[model samples]
Target: MPFIPHTDDDIAAMLQTIGAPSIEALFDEIPAALRSGERDEIPPALSEQAITRLMRLRAQGDEQPSCFIGAGAYDHYIPAAVWQIATRGEYYSAYTPYQAEASQGTLQVLYEFQSMMTALTALDASNTSLYDGATALAEALLMAVRANRRCKSKRVLIPRALHPFYRRTVRTIVEPQGLELIEVDFDAASGQTPVERCAALAGDQGLAAVVINQPNFFGVLEAVDALTDWAHEQGALAVAVVNPLALALLTPPGEWGAAGADIACGEAQPFGMPLSSGGPYAGFLCSKQALVRQMPGRIVGRTLDADGKPGFTLTLQAREQHIRRSKATSNICTNQGLMVTAATIHLALLGTEGLEQVARTCHANTARLCDQLCALPGVERAFSGAVFHEQALRLPQAPNTVLERLASEADLLGGCALGEHYPELDDMLLVCATEQRTEEEMQRYATALATILNAA
Candidate 1:
């Protein structure tokens, strides 16, 4: 039997109560042309084997091109075990733990994820997860505004060096709430947000926070220590936007300066999440325990139950859904649970040393590829600074022209063109070479780029 919740009498009673003559009257507002009249014309369902074959045929149309673009989403090798375990029925179908105590297994995985994030960021605490890196930064900005008791002003110093998408997302989320985001310029030569530029804002009385992106959008490492200290000197919180994998090699935000960054957040896509065409990626947000209450999303905590057995439960139900809407710390309704599960398993499979190795390999490959590409005529470094796994190269010809030719002729998904966002750097192309890129692949890319440039 089809599990229909309402009987004929129940439907009739509901329609009568609502002053509708029949159930179809509810959708009378919808135009007849727009609606499918009936299910009679629907095709018969295919058998299991036939469906599988059809899906395979459809899948063949999708091309897995060698990816080099890493604006925010990354391409990293996921150990087969990461997804195999994450996609298991137990972990895959789990949702937000609203009941708290009942969903022990789901809550435990989230707890582990929080623990891992704190460890990686070297922060006092971490929330379960957020929508993605961009929104996480937006949340961090809002959290800073709420938590900074000393700075009453909603003015935040945001660097142009931060990812362009993150900056736009932050503006969309916080501007309506009366938060003012002040744009700070990066040193053109270094692609680093100079402390001197931020220092000018010292005279401004109510600076809420300063946003710092380590190995920022251009992949050039920022002077985080100087920037963090500068924000503190101005009576503002320092919000660090970071790449999770880079934390393994670079100085974690928790140790940025004499006092350290107050909050750290970024995308966890590099961990175990695949770049499924820029979708469903996980974001992580960590903060000093002082700002924990102001943080958004679900926070899973572990403790012992009455029987003295260990247990996991949701702590700090700060969203509007759980608390009085007016008193809620954040309007965010839920966290990215499945992505967090995959990240937890990914981190567990690759311990501290293993994660560090991956970071080192990514850096090494990027540096090598940068060197090879720069050797070609008209191809030069866009910024003269040390980078992590991504670098911007100044192409002789138009970036789109080169990218289109590379894709059509070489079957290569070329790097992102900086022209769209940074008009001044229109000739530049930002590329990344993760640990997944091999020596041969890098050489191929270099050769293809050279040919395209030479032809142009």
Candidate 2:
């Protein structure tokens, strides 16, 4: 009976404790139309061996050749050491360190992750972690409103070139809070947000924040200093969502001005995490010391233990959901611990030089791919701008049809089509080339794309 985990008697007893006759009674509040009216066709049970075989067959059918998709998730190489270390039982099963003494190791890793993020963003402080880049941007906008004392004129300006998901996330979070979301146009020629136009828009709105992505969604780096100054003059906070790996070659958002960015947030998937079909990735949020109090997630701090030895503790609990309840800075309950640990270990393994090498290879590989793609008959750069690992190109034919042909006929993943988001870019394809991409891979991609276009 115990092997069943929840026997009929146990379920009845539990339901009795809750004053419910049956499980169906618990769902009375749910709308009738939304509830499932019937059961699925799956068998009630199967032997362990049969289940294993069925799962394996399904997995085998799902496997495909190596892909080149990088709309946001990338296909970079993850070292064996990353999985080897992360899979250790202690780390794999650990929960949040509510008590610092019992969680010294986890706390220390979080503390180090915070430190590493600070160095990467060149900011004074960083929280342990966030849900992901999109949520982090949402939290950052909320933090800006908090820092500005919930001014009615609080407006957050986002660049058109920022990740589409991040834009939607911010809108979702801010609109409910009565905060204004202003979308600024990017220079179509350069794929960069025109700071002058942004400055002109910032006039007297009591703007709370201005967000721009470095090596933006199109992979074009924005003029951070100009944008930062413009935002500051309008009494607004400057937030930059940066690519963690790209920070190795470019100046961090923190270095844009004297104290750097008011808040710097970005996806940490490039570190050691996998695409895993777009998640579960980690997001990092960093800010100057002055604004550390306004950071949404947990903050790990160093302290001295009873033995007078250096120890780590989760500091700044006042900013979290438990302490503040509905009044908390953010309702983000769980920090992405496993992913954070992987990133910390990955960064440690790379050190300073290794990160730079990764960044350099990304740039070089992208440049090579861009050149080859541009030489195709009807393919051209979408924007005549400097870029990093990803670039956009205009194709003569419909991007979606061309992409389908590339995948079906040429056995390629092809590039992300832009028509879904930008109507004018119906024929544009967004492609990315990382360190994992070789010269041969680049050539194959170009040849496949060109062949598809010519045939079409």
Off by over 4 Å in 2: 1-43, 46-48, 149-152
* Cα lDDT of model 2 by residue, 153-240, tens digit: 7788889888888888878877898878888989989888998878767757578888868988888878888888777777788898
Clashing pairs in 1: none
Worst 10 residues of 2 by lDDT: 62-71
For residue 437, model 2's alpha carbon misses the true position, in angstroms, by 1.6
Q: Which candidate number would show the highest lDDT if scored against the true structure? A: 1
lDDT of 1: 0.88
C-alpha RMSD in Å of predicted model 2 compared with the true structure: 4.3
CA deviation > 4 Å runs, candidate 1: 1-58, 318-320
Q: What is the lDDT of every predicted structure here?
A: 0.88, 0.85
